[model samples]
Target: MQQSADILKLFEESAIAAGRVILDIYRAGAAVRLKGDTSPVTEADEAAERLILAALARHMPDVPVVAEEEVAAGRIPDVSGGRFILVDPLDGTREFIGGHDDFTVNIALIEAGTPVLGVVHAPALHTLYLGGAGKAEKVKLDDKDAVIARMPIAARLKGASPSALVSRSHNCDATDAYIRKAAILERKTVGSSLKFCMVAEGVADLYPRFSPTMEWDTAAGDAVLRAAGGMVATEDGAPLTYGKRLPGLRAFENPPFLATGRPSERG
Candidate 1:
């Protein structure tokens, strides 16, 4: 895209479009299956991913797409240039299948191993978060998914009584210890990348994820959080970068990390 605005519009539209398809399938009660990794998958995931891939192909022909379902199907594109789009058409398959509203459609642009733009859309909740070009925003949608309101958002500086956001589907002792060690005064359970959006909106101050996650699962939310003046860092306080392929590890695998609404020196 020539401008950041163009990228933002495309990301937002593409995410929302995929979300619409997901909702349609969700309403009809989709059948569930398992991927090679034993994680759950549904028709909504496949259908939404297909819709997102097509949209990206049409609008961002030059950019490579590393989408979840596509990767599972051995359809990975060449992202050697360090610039590509990461997509999780349905970020919270379990939540969706469980009839919860925490699932989302996620899209992000990674440049030089860092996300510069991102969009997260929750169709069931009619909520969206966009981040890029030094701006981060939360959008409210109507029943038909039309934008009803938009507000600028930014991360709040950490304070003494910081709150934490934890995952509903994947809970671990490591995360709990981190929260306890940090002395987090409050905690909330969330699914999908909505945890990152909540931090971006200043609703929470921290999100510590110790569970295994792929790049697509976190890229979009990471972008939004970063754009909102927040930070995603490894345990050592280093900025979390994408395009990772450590030896003996799966491609796009991520290390345990912490998410916070603090000023990121790396940014």
Candidate 2:
């Protein structure tokens, strides 16, 4: 097994490289195309995925990679060993296309069905989150994608009237209803895996997603959150596991999950 520091560094470098590619496309106003599922894809997504996949192949050839654009193009690899890397080269594609700054590049290492290391970089926002080796931290990035400053981060224990983070683009009535039922003190709508990072950094208390999400969408942020003393669980209160596959179907799909900074409270 690779040392946690090595894995974390690899993930950070891959995410930053991918983030640079994404920002270049964002500035150029990338053209969007629809996939078979009707989800929007952009040049930024493909370019970033290629960059990340190449970096991983060079540094960690023994590990498999399950990347978004590749899988969408029918490049599925065998993940039966439950160890691999997950990449969402450009998560929140809709947000990116809409010119929102919440999109991110996510890279994660999954071992035996658990996310062991992760790095999430928001190029437009100039923010990055890293988690692994029993620690998590948030960093400020420069325009050139260099780290300016960083501070360790952890989830805050929930108090009375906790806040919640929800998807700004994919918001549904079911989520709103859940927030109401939880007696949430506040609700903030943001895009991409940043929701998970928010809880990890104590910016928010809870993030519940009742809508559809793939594992790549959540794994990296889930790793960061878990490393920061948070938890991501299914509706049945089970921790979300990776390397999931259906018989003769798509692999690494995810079920509805709830992420919380404070497992003790329901908000």
Candidate 3:
């Protein structure tokens, strides 16, 4: 139990440190570049990844890391042991470039095909959300990285006309279909993993993604949500797993998945 708590602490510190780096670049604006996959990346992403990677290595050198920027550069680590960390130093790059507060720094620990822990930090929003060890919480941080407040959170029960969220950057036909088929009466379009955090904290009830995504994009928020009593599942209603490199599939690519504040809505 103590060991789990310690790793959770490491995730918090590493995420905050990375968020600070990202905020530095975010304030000054950033130069945009396209990765080989045609995704947007900025200096903040690279710099934060460097800082987070070093922190993780320093604390847990034996465990491998699968960070987005590093993977983009073809630096895949061996995570066959099914125990690894996933980092998206700067999620919602498009939103960040567009001067939105929805961008976040995401980190998660994946074990045996499950995300057992996660930390998602939105520096611009000055809010951090984390989950692990059978609980989840939201944190308010000051400019100096001091925790000003913290509170436990949990997923809400699904109600009539439960709210749903879609990605501001990645909404597509399949998502629209899900929203319609699910009879979503209220919906909000937001960016990054905040969708997951919102559901984990009872702010929203559902988030479904039928488009392409990397494991790092969802793992942290998935962990937090799960810890808060939420569930993330693929189209077949199976739990989402990490460290994927299947035949004819790009490594670490995620299947179309749905994230719900309550497990009752799995589909």
Candidate 4:
């Protein structure tokens, strides 16, 4: 229990530190570059990843790390032990570049292919979500990254008409069709893993993603949601697992999944 608590603390601190680096770059105006996958990356992402990787190495050198920018640069580490760190230094790069406040910094610890500890920090929004040590909480942070208040969070019970959240950048016809079939009462679009955090906090009831995503992209938020009495699962109703590899991909990727604040409504 103590060890899990320590790791959770490490994740929260590292996420906040990375958020600082990201916010600095965001303020100074970041330079954008495109990855081979045609995805946009910025100096903020690289610098934040460096800071987060260094912090994780200093605090937990034995644990392997699989970070987005590092993996994109071909720094795939051995994660055969089912325990490793996942970092998405700057999630929602497009939103960040567009001066939107929805981007976030994600850090998670996956053990036995399940996220056991995680932290998601939105620097511009001054919000942080943390899960581990048998609890989940949403924190309000100040401009200097100091925690102002924190309160336990949990997913709401399924209602007559549950709200649904979708990706702001990748909302396609398939996602729309799924939401329509679910007969959701309302819909909200958000960037980054905030969609998961919203469900974790009971602000939204469901988030279904039909598009491709990486493990690091969702693990932290997944941890938070699960800790908050929610769940993320594949379309087949199996829990989402990390450390996945596709046939031709060296990096970890996620299959299509659904995140729900009300587990009973998952069906």
Candidate 5:
């Protein structure tokens, strides 16, 4: 129990430190470039990743790290042991590039295909959300930071009018169809895992990713969402699992999944 709590503390600190580093860069605003995948990559992402990676290496050296920037740079970590760190130093790269304060630094610990701990920090917005060890909370991190919200798993909804949180960047036809058919009323276009955080905090309702996403993209968010009474599940209604050992599968490419706050509504 102590070890779990300690690891959770490390995860939280790493996320907040990464968020601070990213916020410094975001405030200054640097030149942005596109990665080979045509996704945005900034100096903030690189620097924050460097900071967080070093911290994780120092604190949890035995656990391998699978970071987005490192994968993009062709340095995939070995996850054969089925336990490792999943990270997106800057999740909303496009929003960061576009000068929107909607980006996030995301990290999660995946063990045997389950996210046991997760942390997400929105540096620009000065907010942080985390979950682990059967606990989930949201902190508003201004100059004087404070825990503004404690998240609880949502109860069954009264109506079928579930709320939906969609990507501000990657909305697609499939996503549109899900929203329409799902009878989503309150639609929020939040970037990065903040979309997931919304459901975790009971601010928004559901999140459906009809488009492609990698395991790392949602692992941390899923952990927090699940910890706070939500879930990320495969289309077949199975819970989303992570850190699978596929010899040739890419590091951060995610499959289509849904983040639903109301598990009871699945019928």
Candidate 6:
């Protein structure tokens, strides 16, 4: 971790670059493939990963990157010590394939099993959410950088719904049950990591996904949510703590989790 300013600026640049790659492939309609996990993959993922990885290497050379495409290509980086960046170049392949504008570019800095900074950029939406330095703010960037909404955690506007923003394409049975039991007021379906960003920006209240998810899938959003006074927790109400080293494990995966808008909102 460097200065919060430098890291965040680097993250914003990389995220927007990845966003450009995503939008290009998205509009051009690229080829699609499947990974070993049976998840969708596309050239956009690879291109975005390349762009993000290159930026990270040039700017934060010391920080290793755990990228989704690289991991799927059997090239997971070594993150056994210190700090690293976790990236998901194309987070919602389903939404991307369906010709919807819900996918995003995700990037995060993790130190000692905790994410210290995160950025989520939805190029199609022209929205960027950044959280770090004990603060979180949502920025809407255009040809010129402009701050659309900037507020510390406590100053965000509260929504009218007991809002539950869930994955647009990957809904599980457990999520249905959670939503019903929670008595949600409004439901918004968006793809990719933007679900988490919705909560971070106060557009929604909670996101509960009781389905299996890899660490990279949630690390960036997790950091943003946490920095914005929210948390990703387990069923038992434990805040997600990443990067646990096991004796022989090469890397790690996350269990089913719940993402909430506020600590007190957890029930």
Model 1 spans with C-alpha error above 4 angstroms: 264-267
For model 2, what is the C-alpha lDDT against the true structure? 0.90
Candidates 4 and 6, the one with greater TM-score: 4
Clashing residue pairs in candidate 2 (N, C-alpha, C atoms within 3 angstroms) = none
Q: Model 1 clash tally? A: 0
Give the 10-residue window scoring lowest on summed lDDT in candidate 4. 244-253
lDDT per residue (tens digit) for residues 1-267 in model 3: 238789889999998988888888988989999999899999999999999999888889888999999999999999999899999999999999999999999999999989998999999998999999878999999989999999999999888888999999899999999899878889999999999999999989999998889999999999999999999988888888999876766899998998998767653
Single out the weakest 10-residue window by summed lDDT for candidate 2: 245-254
Error of 1 at 31 (Å): 0.4
- 127-201, model 6: which lDDT tens digit per residue? 888888878878777644455665454313344557788787888888989888877768888788888877887
Question: Which tens-of-lDDT digit does each residue in 1-267 have in candidate 4?
Answer: 239888888888888888888888898999998999999999999999999999888889988999999989988899999988899999999999999999999999999989988999999999999987799999999888888999999999878878889988878888889888877769988999999999999988889998888999999999999999899998899999999876754457787889988657666
TM-score winner, 3 or 5: 3
Q: Candidate 4 regions off by >4 Å?
A: 246-250
**Ordering by lDDT:** 3, 1, 2, 4, 5, 6
Compared to the true structure, candidate 5 yields what TM-score?
0.92
- The true-versus-predicted C-alpha distance at residue 97 of model 3, in Å, is 0.4
Regions of model 3 farther than 4 Å from truth: none
Q: Per-residue lDDT for 1-267 in model 1, tens only?
A: 468899889889988988889999999999999999999999999988888889888888999999999899999988999999999999989999999999999999999999999999999999999999889999999999888999999998877688899999998999999888877779999999999999999988889999888999999999999999888998788889899887766899988998889774222
Q: Which parts of model 6 are misplaced by more than 4 Å?
A: 143-161, 245-251
- Collision pairs in model 1: none
Clashing pairs in 6: none
In the range 4-103, model 2's lDDT, one tens digit per residue, is 8998998888888888888888998999999999999999999999998898989899999999989999998888887889999999999999999999
User: Could you tell me every candidate's TM-score relative to the true structure?
Assistant: 0.97, 0.96, 0.97, 0.96, 0.92, 0.90
